[model samples]
Target: MAMMPRMELRQGQSLVMTPQLLQAIKLLQLSHLELQNFVEGELERNPLLERDDAADVPPHANGGDGPLAADADSFARAESLNSQDGMETRLGTALDNVFQGEQPTVARLDTHGADSLPVIGGAYGGSGGSFEEGPEGFESSLTAEASLHDHLGAQLDLAITDLAERIIGQHLIDAVDDSGYLGEPVGEIAERLGITSARVERVLAVIQGFDPSGVAARDVCECLSIQLRDRNRFDPAMQALVSNLHLVAKRDFAALKRICGVDDEDIADMVAEIRRLDPKPGRAFGGSTAETVVPDVFIRAAPDGSWLVDLNPDTLPRVLINQTYHARVSRAARNDVEKAFIAECLQTANWLTRSLEQRARTILKVASEIVRQQDGFFAHGVEHLRPLNLKTVADAIGMHESTVSRVTSNKYLTCSRGVFEMKYFFSAAIAATGYGEAHSAEAVRFRIKQMIDDEKPAEVLSDDAIVSKLKDGGIDIARRTVAKYRESLRIPSSMERRREKVAMAAGGR
Candidate 1:
């Protein structure tokens, strides 16, 4: 064969990820808040993309100029028709598009002859006319509240005269967790600070007496005892009950009565007093705001006994290509740069709209498939949550496993049972008891939790016992598997449970 350059004609299909396609994929996985931020940025950069405000067109309609003809001079005139200020005014409407499920109205034009600016609605209390409605002091009050550490440090600095005691007190305060219990032992603190245990104890005792009655206690016993003493109820019975908190926790009233040398009535009163005290004093001081969980898909029971899967309108991004603006800009575009800009904007706007729609459809498809496959779970409970994986959903939906994974990732589905992460439906399979369908590990775990929760304190269920119970229920799981599941659920072993029960029983006395 001659090795020479030759011209050949061939055609082959290839997959290329364009920027718009990449954007679509990126948008698919973004949370609602993130998508809002992204859309806001796009609105700022693209002038042609304007939010669709559902207000009738102005009666005069841009100086009664019906429409511009497709001509160079008409385009030149159109260029002047939409000034930079007017374009900016249009872009301001982009803020309105950031929120979904709301009709975006035109921003009222400024009375001083400036173009109307669109303002974000009820987002961060920004000065957006009616959108500026929120609890005026709610956010400020939260921010102004003193934290646990601040509260303790202020009292320490004000009350403590000795510098050494104050220093030790500060270290001890730092050791106290948000739950008001000292994570580190007093002996360990003394070792770490080269101070005597007595000195650390002294400083701790003082810190415990801060504004919150149980601010720096070593354990629940100390926390409750401090509160009892503050209320002048630290009697022999109360002292005995406080010392044996473990028994109190397990509701061992008889044992608590014995330990406290009090009758049933006296023990009950002491227990009630202890119950009234705040175990976690630090919690009284506000902490970080809880992160809200928003579902991506909602599945409800249809009238026909079928599961209806729908995308959460709140999370779904609503966007559209402004054909009106695109036409205006296209006819007015003069130079190559201007024409290219207009064309690119039109393409991006169209692609974004299509991508959002596609994203919604794909999500709905995957979710619908999930609900179909795990229909029993929705109808019954987690016990019926079959052993599912991405491959199973992908096969059912006729999509690739990766696509299913992408759709499910960072996505949550809410149904009659509860809000659950999409991944929660999938679980490793457990071997069936010699026949029938394979068992779901999640169901087995739930079963184990139920068994433990229902077990009597005296008859605390061991892992082996759990394994036996599971076998009786037709789940062929081993002792180690039960142990692993129990650990995963953070359930203490049988011996620990027994001790806790015994302690509670003793404390009640």
Candidate 2:
């Protein structure tokens, strides 16, 4: 080896993730809400970017002169071509080919046409109305209801008069959780407040008598006892039943009857009464409002007996670059700094608009492929859902599996059956017994549920029986797999189901 300095030329290639490419990837995965917020932030930052609120102008209206007008024309032409062609024809190449390392093709979005934009009818089976109206009509006008804390605070204010007792009551109320159970023990509260346990107990007693029946109990047993006492039904038998809730959970009627010292009819009555008690009293108040899920794509049946997939225009963020303003700003730039800033803004704005357009198109392309692959599910039911995976969709659409995964995340599809997350269509395949098509785990689960639902009380199907039935139907599944699916469906073991059915039969008589 010689210690010398020499110069040699080398050639190599590497994949670089530019800022704009990263932004495009981020935008593709964002849910509709997140994308809107991101676009709004960009609009505020970039003077050249503006909301595309103007009425739809034909590409020829301005003689297709400026870059903006040219982009509009290209988008319009692309949309027209897409509408005329079938999905299979339009998705001949991967979206990555059109955008990555190539000139991006902007897809036109028709805000008015039913054939292009999502409507409320076909797949949704909704009456004639706009699907984009959202929850603004009556829900927007309604006032917020009182929370559990507020409700309890108001009751504490009126119920407690003595300053010392009121202070203790307030501390106890603060300790109560959303489930209406007192989170802190009386001794801990007393120690924390530097008071006696007796004082805390006294205050807890007074607070428990407040409205909502069981606002300040320490445990489920105490909560049920408080409610039963209020109803003047907390007798010795009911007390015994409440104390031994484990027996009730197991549906051990014999043990419950022996422990409660009541006959079958009496024990049943007491158990029914216990069931009527509110387990979580505070849940009825002070909860966060439920958010409505807005679907990203709409699928409807076409007149030609095929699925018509369309992107929800409402979810699409409509934005555009103001070329006229950019031109004016560029002409008036006083220095290179201002000129560079303006140029950067223009580039960023152009990228965002193109990215949004591409994001919408990518979603539409992937969703169309899913609808095509799961056509049986749409036409029939969950029982017909074919086994699918991210790789299968990615390969079919000529995209990376990671890209397909991101598109399906936080995205939903609406169809005749109902609104479902895009990921819901994907399931592991259960092998077929012979030379037949593999069954989707979801479809197999549905079949199991159906079988159980139709089984007579005398003929309750165990996991083994269910497995045998599935094998008969060409689904080669294991007993453990069936058991796992049954558990996922919230179904109990065969013995528990049999016990429940027998109890129900006796109760019916």
Candidate 3:
């Protein structure tokens, strides 16, 4: 082949991520506290960006609000929220105090059900101290509440035969979710906890009989069966119910009646009795209350029928280039290496300042679009959370989905209702039927939770029943899908729910 030297121009479309742009995108996903820490680090390394102590503070200046002083932590912030410098973290609120003195404690404490080990910030006067007041100047509705696993583990500690049994029980308790149900398979939990599955099953059997009754079972069926055994009223019909939990779950009344050798009337009685067991024995967990997310941005409704969207001032950090060192380095620089280093520092400092500005703009733009999309949620409540997606907000703000995704990832938006992660507002769309308008999946989930809560003990709604109820409100969901949503919400199946009721009744009696 002969090579011909020719100059031609062609055009094509392509996407490339520049190093700086990637950095910017990475910064976007960081929570308020994370970004603040990042900027503080940048200030130490770069001599240009300076944090002001006594001057007019910039809109999002670090340490601007003077942070919650260590001593005033009890007076100022809630245990579930912590303010360092000027940044606040809802999940990691007590970090500063965890490492305040010569003794260093891990800032983030384990939220798992491991008792005996006090919860994170437990010693800082969290449960019974002045710290209960929450952060000063900021209001949070979520009170610290005890978790389900903790309750189960506490009971296990008292009930188990030995240390190994207790250890196994703790492993099982750890496997349970927030609602106190074992979402993980017993086999999987055994492998993870480095115990034999047999040990897990044995200890789990013991745990199920522990106080609160329905704990440590892999599925709702087992949970109920264990509770039933504890009741010492197990019958062939009841035994058949637990053994064929899947059939009972499907409402296969014909088959269940045949298997239990019962008629329609007896079927109703058996089902009712089965329904009276406890599924999540750990749900009665006691300790802290009021767990909630704190938003990074606050949109204040002005008296003038307008809005003032601002970053939570509590998250503003006090960080910047040390003014004295910066001035000294600039004046006394003489060597080539020194000048080059200073030049690099200057570039880094400028980039950091610009990055901070861009960070605020991006967050504000995203949050504003969220407010626009979820105006109903703000005005009404969570039920009004519109069906939204990352692309929806990105398109409205003239950005990319990835950009919006990163922005909403760790960011929180605080409003009059409460603090929620930025992503909570965006939900999958549930197509509307002939009944009414389409709804957001989150709204549906919330509704499902509510419906389950309000159901009369004598009449727990099944998936089909739930579907009918949702249809009345305009949503067309299937029973299986409803069951899926229920599971996702860490809710019990109908049988497990009935069992829980029975256990609760027995306890009450």
Q: Estimate each model's TM-score.
A: 0.61, 0.75, 0.54
Runs in model 2 deviating more than 4 A are 1-10, 54-142, 159-209, 216-222, 232-240, 283-286
RMSD of 2: 15.8
Looking at candidate 1, the ten consecutive residues that score lowest on lDDT are 53-62
Over 4 Å off, model 3: 3-20, 33-209, 244-255, 263-269, 286-291, 300-304, 328-350, 369-401, 410-509
Q: Candidate order by lDDT, highest to lowest? A: 2, 1, 3
Model number with the top TM-score: 2
Query: Which has the better TM-score: candidate 1, or candidate 3?
Result: 1
Better of 1 and 3 by lDDT: 1
CA lDDT for candidate 1: 0.70
lDDT at position 406, candidate 1: 77
Model 3 worst lDDT window (10 residues): 102-111
Top-lDDT structure, candidate number: 2
> What TM-score number comes out for model 1?
0.61
Q: What is the C-alpha RMSD of each candidate to the true structure, in Å?
A: 17.8, 15.8, 16.4
